[model samples]
Target: MSGAVWDAGRCWRCEADDVPVIWLGPVQTQEHGAGPFAACEPCIRRLEQLVETHHMQADRSA
Candidate 1:
């Protein structure tokens, strides 16, 4: 599903028309287990920021 065209209207991030949204989920690898989740670009960035902040806080506490 890499080259599949996603409808922009279904995106939870941008309101732009025909924005190519991708489904990033079910990241099951041999090393890591599977999880139920998906994200758009904006949401992915937000999650990254949140994780960074959480790690920073933990580091400061330690």
Candidate 2:
């Protein structure tokens, strides 16, 4: 979807209508265009922390 469409509603995570503080960094690619799915600041930070934690866990297991 286009950036306008992607950002047209509340954050996909927290469902807030505030101005964008950050994004999920393009986890999906639209067939017609490209845009990073947006998320609230708390959601973004939580997602990043989860990713880092998972990576660390994977490294430890490896």
Candidate 3:
């Protein structure tokens, strides 16, 4: 969950540019293959929620 703050960059999820970003980690895509991923604050929060929800569901299933 460690990240580096960026003043301006493109978000991998929403494709937003020229905004504050958090450089999280690497990601893979069919088009670009694999590289570092950056996301805006909102996208980052959304992704964190998704991961938390997924883990909660998994725990319930277990």
Error of 1 at 6 (Å): 10
lDDT of each: 0.60, 0.66, 0.86
Q: How close is candidate 3 to the true structure, as a TM-score?
A: 0.78
Show the colliding residue pairs in model 2. none
Residue-pair clashes per prediction, in order, are 0, 0, 0
Which runs in model 2 stand beyond 4 Å of their true positions? 1-9, 26-36
Per residue, candidate 2 scores C-alpha lDDT tens digits across 1-62 of: 13522344457677788655455556555575666568766676798799999999999999
The alpha-carbon lDDT assigned to residue 5 of candidate 1 equals: 44
TM-scores of the candidates are 0.46, 0.57, 0.78
Local error of candidate 3 at residue 34 (angstroms):
0.8
Q: lDDT by residue for model 3 over 1-62, one digit each (tens)? A: 45455668889889998878887888988897989888998998999999999999999999
After aligning candidate 2 to the native by TM-score, how far in Å is the CA of 56 from where it should be? 0.6
Candidate 3 residue runs with Cα over 4 Å from true position: 1-4
Best by lDDT: 3
Ranking by TM-score: 3, 2, 1
How displaced is residue 2 in candidate 1, in Å?
A: 14
